[model samples]
Target: MANIKLTVEEMKYMALLQDLTGAVARDCIIDNENNRIIFIVRPGDAGKAIGRRGANINKLRRLLGKEIEVIEHADDLEAMVKNIFAPARVLGIRLAQRNGRKILYVTVDPNDKGRAIGKGGRKVNIARLVLKRYFDIDDIKIR
Candidate 1:
């Protein structure tokens, strides 16, 4: 079996997420280079983790004193795509631009692709919005 190691911020994020949502979060990561954090949990748990309109998340941002990003997992294709582009969840992200258009491409665990895209592409849309705003990307594509 392969072992996965987590950084200090990832550990802290797990602690904070559990404290807020009482859910078991996995695959927590902190992108020191980008100054962001990411984790995985069921979509149903997202509301609790984020709080009412993101109140808990706001608190985490203040406490961490750095930018924070969350990726809610679902067990579907579109949801997985959304998860992949979630700045924090993306293990390796590459940006490509053409004709004044920007495209954000991301790679995620094969098993997680479905959950990232979500049902009927709802999650994908939301993730696209997030990527557009934060990364200024015109489009998000996952593999």
Candidate 2:
């Protein structure tokens, strides 16, 4: 695990999320470009964060005026990557170190490649950002 830092604003968001969803968040990523907020909650708390029928997420979306995404945190890098790319079935995850940089190669179901990549590769970019922050991974290559 890498040393994680949360901005004051991020900490506020995390606090709000926990208050609203009853799930303590490990980290919060505010994607201003995407108009989205992503939260990584502690293990065994994803269900609580999402709530029944996604009521919690919907409420947060309305309150924050942006898309809200909740991901469960995992100690394992592979599991973390998989959680980040949920709804897009991942076939494999390979971590490679070259020189002084580390790269993650993720293989998703061929049919779900575009979904995993998201519009304009936004999903991959967010995944890469999260990986870099949480695991100190340098890059992510979606295959």
In TM-score terms, which candidate is top? 2
- Indicate which candidate wins on lDDT: 2
lDDT against true structure, model 2: 0.90
After TM-score superposition, what is the CA distance of residue 74 in candidate 1 from its true location, in Å? 4.1
lDDT at residue 14 of model 2 (Cα atoms): 95
The digit string of per-residue lDDT tens for model 2 on 10-88 reads 9999999989988999999988988988899999899999999999999999998999888889999889988889889
Against the hidden reference, what TM-scores do the models get? 0.52, 0.88
Model 1, span 6-90: residue lDDT tens:
6786787798779876766765755565566666666666667778887888888888876655667665444554454543354
TM-score of 2: 0.88
Error of 2 at 57 (Å): 1.2
Model 2 ranges with Cα > 4 A deviation: none
How many angstroms is residue 78 displaced in model 2 relative to the true structure, after the best TM-score fit? 0.6
RMSD of each: 10.6, 1.7
- As a whole number from 0 to 100, the lDDT of residue 109 in candidate 1 is 69
